[model samples]
Target: MTSTDKYIEMKVPAFILTGLLCGLLLQPVAAQTGPAHNRPNIILIMSDDMGYSDLGCYGSEISTPNLDSLAMTGLRYTRFHNMGHCCPSRAALMTGLYPHQTGLGWMTGTNFHLPGFTDELNEHCVTIAEVLKTAGYATLMAGKWHLSHNIHAGGPQHDWPLQRGFEKFYGILTGAGNYYDPASLCRDNTLITPLNDPEYHPQHFYFTNAITDNAVRFMQERPKDKPFFMYVAYTTAHWPMQAPEEAIEKYKGKYDAGWDVLRRQRFEREKALGVIDKDATLSPSDTHPWAEEKDKAAMARRMETYAAMITIMDQGIGKIVDELKKEGIFDNTVIVFLQDNGGNAEGTGFGGPEGETRPVVPKNAAALKPLGKDEVQYAINPPVTRDGKRVMQGKNVMAGPADTYLAYLKPWGNLSNTPFRKYKNFVYEGGVATPLIIHWPDGIKAERGAVRTQSGHEIDLMPTIAQLAGAKYPSVYKGNEITPVSGISLIPTFEDKPLPPERAIYWSHQANRAMLMGKWKIVSGGILNGPYGKWKTYVSLPWQLYDMENDRSEMRDLSAEHPDIVKKMAAMWDKWAHSTNVYPMPWKEVKPPLRPDYMSTPWEYPDF
Candidate 1:
């Protein structure tokens, strides 16, 4: 039956009631009718590789007055998590399901267990944009779209942002790139002119600033009457450790105390602020003592660079927020700020083929030796001696010719994680944990700076947005039944209610598999392939269990004493892995797996 006919049939009883009320009150039925739609505008701001405590509101010494103000006026989630890495997290956020459900069970590339991630987001899954757009919302997106690298192959590809439901698109298509010279920057499928020339577009060239500018333009041109959904993805706080000179200068010498003191300070502040369990213990240092000692100076500089990146990104975000307020939409717009992943532990300093197209080390060392060649400029501060002598020593200077080698040294990266254990890419708290701030002036009433103890994952993004916009999720996309939406709405938490019960959340990238069933987490990543592959699990690898209620930092592992709990959790994890087809693949050691033939499958009608 037609939609109009269905609506007419359902409205017969309501019409009869309305007629009776009209007859009694001598009023027109239209006079008492409600407005057609009242969906609020949504602005989703995402930062790349931002640590849990990088924002001023998150207890960073770095001055982020705007973001601090945002945190104060919004709802801060203490235990929110991304999917441990970028592409996968974004995929989960976009699809409202686990990363594996989106086919990006891992990173993009051939070496990982999941190779050729083009199938990561199939036509089956409806994006948050597609759902909103279908409901008449104007969709705009800015920043990273790392779902597929094929966009960089230089052709008229139909699988880009515009194709994926965004009415407008800007920013890089890859994971990481030079902030100053964005390699895969695109302006709606067209390659943006690179900022390679020193004289061209000088100040407006940084990828973060450019993205903000484009986003602002997109917003300004949008119709005020139409509800809008914008995904502002900033590539700041990622690597290449480059930022505006002013921002870098602002943080210079801020980390002289090094990682040890900084981490402790952050932990104490978080505890006092009630961002984490007051009695929660801090995780032990995961980096080797000697390595930490060797890179102190470089580490400090690296952090300085990273802080600068975050500061600038925050500044850009502030501009966007200011624009919204100026346009009188701030109060109604649902603003959500989160990170694609946790702060990275990827080796930024000692450069190699760490995946950058250009060799991280300068080609001619003798020519650029004064500028620091093989050495990644940023160093992690190591342990101090009993006498209080500084350890992890290295020269502090910018690494790149235009930017810096610019990596955020180790000590600061460790501290960026604050109370958490490892850094980005790992399944540890350090990798998955991310600071999430939700600001909706109309719907959220917790307080100016309310703290919430809700557990949020990337998958929850789609469902929450869908609920907010009052759009029904499409069960079938491109004719096949898509995986059901696995995330629940977070609206209850916004009302200051206790966080709802969470059954489980799972993650896997490469051979790394992590599962969280309530407070118990089972994470194991070792060199083995397939479900039945020989496994040399880490005995000392620490099978951790947190009360979570009491130990938000995950410092104390009650696993040894709780053997039965550990066994149960592990068994549950194994069952999930097998059911989800998460067997490891030694893609790095063998030839590429044969691509699935979509033509062999039955085709579905295209409605999405």
Candidate 2:
């Protein structure tokens, strides 16, 4: 009132002066300060369908220098876990919630009208990007965006990357496709033609390269005023194993000894590297022996191609790391590299559908051309045309060419998981365990080249990023009440501090179930076929107990000896499944929406 009186005396308009004073008083606190220095940029890189021991640092023969370098400078978590499959692991990683809580208990293709089977990120959850963006971070995503079901549909996709709070997005919207011409390639919210389109001469288009290029571009173009969050989800080393001929050539004759020898070699190396305990016994091979293989040359070639795919991915990572260095942000950037799940065992050993009797084309065939250059199509499962015509998709073609679509299959997949008992889609250590490497030059002051033996899961990533970025998880977001994040932050482990002893991690995929309470774990699923395959029915499978502290490879099943422990763990898992929207397993037939006709265009059906 005194100030207003003074202003009136000075012949100034009281209302105008008061307005000016109020504006000065209400100036934002951020306006008076400099940018936040403690907030670090986050780069979360994930490899699709990669095994736990595929990287060189993790005891693989694969040339992954970039990832290995990252491991040397950063901290490696020896006991990190995935959700035993791609979609669920991804959903868990992005939302900091159980996959079921994020509405992806099943894959993206199916929407069974169940709480956890919606095939899209639910309204109750918030992605890392969404949460970080609210804290003034520029969120970007590159590579696969398999969180939504209708990615191939026309119009602005409601659950696309941009809509999920990514400031910029460049990647395939579907789960998988050809590396040369990926399906549903998009920039931001708009679908675009592949970079190697006919207009571009001498096309050098590759999925991994394209993903890395866009990631670097985002870093270069981002606002300097804000820290950033980037999710670089690479689809390399997944399926349709294709790589540059030169890269494949580099691994020639490397796997000639076959999986029997290779698995043992890798297990020994893992022990030497301290990635796995020396006492950890290698599991007996459920796959056929190397001596029993008829096409040793072709099998070796497939492994070579698989190695090439990983090497190329590593090269792309190198490029991105260089860009980070050039941007002067490498020191503060938090780089987390991990795989989505264990290796796949989907195809036959001879470069086609499992149990196919078709003859495979030799690599020397003049008509075969070079692998990874031509467009190869193949039928994988229930191999047939839409109108019930038998199609020759996987017949008589060598893998590693664009004209050939083949997975490395069970033999290689068994090798890839190394010492573990099963491949992807199971609850065993082979399926769920993954290597997690975190590098933060400024934040992590612990010993370099050190390993953290604590058990962590993909769900821990979002909470870890939130803690590192000083971002708060909102209780309510955009008018919807959000679910609490189900992950515990791994910040304490970065400083070599011990994690809490009582933390429990749970996993459920396609009826395969597991629970880890302390060092005790109870698992209930394995391979889906053959004598060793214990996976039969979803609901009635016997729960097997493992003292994880002693048996990391899951060679022994202690369910009978520890019935009380198994009972307790099973009850706990049931409680988690019920509370987390994981019930009503979508094992029944669910007719999904008609996928658009993209085969004429570059898109192809995923080999899930």
Candidate 3:
């Protein structure tokens, strides 16, 4: 029978939900042979700032055998996208609601006007944890938790993972920090010490390793009969790109060619591998002319460190997979891997708004120089004491003495974003588009190695997981009412069904707003600074449109030629924005602007 027909035949009536568990438990052994609600265990793995071509399966030359192994046994997605930043993308992924609906319409730093001065997850939404946990799955979270920081302030409320529906939580609370001595590490709601495991030889202090260790522990200790939902988020490959000397040494000379050459090569390789369209145009360089010079050695060294970080993270993933195999649960687990956002260009030397906070290690005076970036460069040799002891200084080189601190320079960062036009903070594809991989050994019907063209977004993940587990999301969770999920399931793609065209995908973070309908996209150069300040908070406009299907690089603007289409799409987009609680202007604007807020801005560079 067809899936819909089967659903109609098997769906329990509203009256049955209350006694469902009792009925299920009382069923005879022979009658319980079928799927227990199609409820397979769910494992979601997220990487940080990973590039489009950073995996072997995606055409990278880096050592990503583990990821490649997963691709060999499952399905790969080529056109999936995120909202383009961390908190926003994560909000969409977890709650299945648009970022605006979750009150994190922009990155935490955007300062978009909200009820409080904090940038925390709103109480109006439901998390995947709350839904799945209620459905009888044990939910656990590990890695970076940027949902809320004020939770630790001992205020009116706390917003850590436990408070948000997760049964177990561990990881950093903020956006960025030192990998070794991160500023914010928590168990439930209390602070903890850094990675000071003397038992582990040579003091191998790395967040990637630590997070993975926690992942394995959780799985090994989980009840075999109870299904699980694990969110394994890793902070590797973001900023503060530090790696072991041996790992960095492997790619020491790999990026000798400047970003221009590297980008074209990676794009061509990705096309050949079917990771992206063969005709997809590469986005143009967004850095200044001075930043383009070929510092082959330095550039290669920087990418080497970056590559090392990814490699290490992959190794950790392998361990987790191995543990599942040991428990004989590998075949039934559904694994989804993705990135929070695109590669970050805010180098280790970058600071403040341009650069997020990174950790600093103490160093001796001789080992110190002007702090270049916020983190350490893997290539730079660590300072050694007169006897030969390696300095254990933290990041943020300029703030302290030797053996006390260390930081990376900015040049390495220029290489991290590589071919992408903009850095982590912008609204460009470089900052938004990310790698998404899905693997299901026994559930998915698609060929093991097939790569589908259907477009997938962060919002789609929730609905997809819900459908897979046959879990019902409630209208209210944790005493707060919730908006229904906005995404459709991807099971259709895996089932080989015809995919639908892009209907309407709108974006707005700190006035960096954009809208995509079918092949056309509209973007403004700036946020919240438009003409006459109508939508006065988002005063940037002069709607530029790009046929994404043909102009994936977003080079040509057809707004003037297709004025009719632009107006129609613009109206539809504005309607969506308003419905989702987006401010007509920046949250800080004193006066509200006209509806639809389409006004031209005075300053704009190419590709906003």
Candidate 4:
């Protein structure tokens, strides 16, 4: 029987009464007896809502000298992939299994009483931190912790970072929040305002800097005798583009050239850098002609602010690396950098009257002038903050300020993913592809700056780390049997080698689905159904195929020419989806409105 013949073996629930029976009987894992130097310190750094070509080495015009330097000294994987959305990507990176198998199939904002969409890290899966801890590595995390839905100040604590695996935690508990005064921000299980936090006090409170500073602090203050694993998840350039004015000044008129020129420039740079194939033609631009746009200046400013946020993040990476060098642990530390997903298409600052013009702040904002220092942030979209100022949002509102919130918008997001076709939430190469930079000075045998083209996924991170740390991936941890790692370690590729040619890489987000096997890929996606409370469905399109070897950008659809391949890959995806709790995808259990023409095939092969 082929992979398409049946669902994957039932992973977590193979044992009966897993949760109830394994109560207080769980014993703590014993420490590792291996030499500390043999097991290197692991630093896994991840960015939120970033694009495939957003790094300087990956083709973007953004200034990311620190990360670019990492690529120069380490290894860059050109064909690396991630889950097409935020939470699921984090879930995949944390657990070696795919998102659904880890019980976080969707965002942590909603729970539909479905096994896969629990909005929490279930007991069935163990995180990398948990596994590494068993090997005597100190686990520290600083940045967005979006695995749990219970973000209230006094809600369930079972799924929070401290409870899951990390010993020290900082950053927001939920997804997407104002950078200046993020909601659900925590400090080692305690919720505290940025200004009110007792341990940290910066001249100003910028979330990216805070996450970075705390990460360095955690590493500096970690037990010197014990090797550590630090996870830095930056929400920079995600939404509400807010960066220091000085950083924003660096890219004032950079993007004035517009997305068209920017796309071509990035495409050329990517080819020149060998990040993409030399013969690979640029994907057709999805953005409109920049000439006709009414507010070109404002459009350009959005990108400038976006670039500044990333540059600030790059500066933070430099700080962390500096600390590693200062402590004499730089050579022995394994640093892996990647993104959660591709560039976001959400239109945050895109709705109102166009042509860019910031009106005066609302009168009510001036009326209630209360200092928000003592207040714990509870609102995801903070209405007012940092002295009770209204958080403004408009196409006219420029992006770099504490009281303003705006996305760089969809057109610029398209540029961020230059040479790729779609945005976040779709399983197209654009949505899933990301730059994966791995640097291990003492361990990696790969040539400095070597680029590996073998496909790797976020799910591979945990396994890779486990292999390097010499950690035993648990059979049963804290009384619950853990799921087998779904991904293989890329350690072999670290020596400038190759991954198995026939291996399959999978992706499923919202109602989009895709599978890459060998040089062929099969994918399908759906449009957003208006607003909230609706189901995401794939009833609008049919399965499409591409020969990734020739068209990694997914420029041509080979579904019609190779129906047999599509059938074969689709069947394999079906089996994997069913076994991983990806089947009965939200839309299947509910009766969502269906598009007429393609409705026939959807029910037979419900996606996502």
Clashing pairs in 4: none
- Sliding window of 10 residues with minimal summed lDDT for model 4: 21-30
Total backbone collisions, model 4: 0
lDDT of 3 by residue, 28-146 (tens): 22221135643578899988776666788886777899889888778888767777777777788888777888877755544546532226678888888887788778889889887
State residue 307's C-alpha deviation in candidate 4, in Å. 0.5
The C-alpha lDDT values of all candidates are 0.66, 0.76, 0.64, 0.81
Which one is best on lDDT?
4
Q: After superposition, how far is residue 276 of candidate 3 from its true place, in Å?
A: 1.8
How many Å off is the CA of 526 in candidate 4? 2.2
Better of 2 and 3 by lDDT: 2
After best superposition, candidate 2 residue 126: deviation in angstroms? 0.7
Query: Weakest 10 consecutive residues, lDDT, candidate 3?
Result: 24-33
Tens digits of per-residue lDDT for model 4, 1-608 = 33422212223221122222222112221232146555789999999999989999898889999999999999999999999888999999999778998888988877777878777988889999999998888999999988988987777899998898899999989887888888888998888988889999999889999999999999878888889999999998798888888888889899988999988999999999999999987877676799988788777888899999999999999999999999888998999999988898887655455534332234555434544677688666665666756777777677788778788877888888878888888899779998999998877776789999888888878777887787777879999988777777777687667765566778888777888877888988754454653655435358899888899888889989878778767777777788788865676433445557844544443332
lDDT of 2 by residue, 1-608 (tens): 23212322343332233224322322222321225665788899999888878999989999899999999999999999999888888899999888998899978877878998887998999999999899899999899988987765465487898988899998887778767656677778766655323322234777788888888888888999888999999998887777778888999899988898888889999999899998998888878899998777767887898999999989989998998898788988889999888988876434343545443343324333322333222222223222223212342344575545567878889888987878888888889999999998977887888999988888778777877776777789999999777877777788777655546788888767888866788887522322232223333356788888899888778888867667766776786788788887655322323456664444332211
Highest TM-score, which number?
A: 4
- Candidate 3 lands at a TM-score of 0.79
Error of 1 at 269 (Å): 1.3
Q: What is the C-alpha RMSD of each candidate to the true structure, in Å?
A: 13.1, 14.5, 8.8, 5.6
Candidate order, lDDT descending? 4, 2, 1, 3
Provide the lDDT at 147 for model 3.
Answer: 79
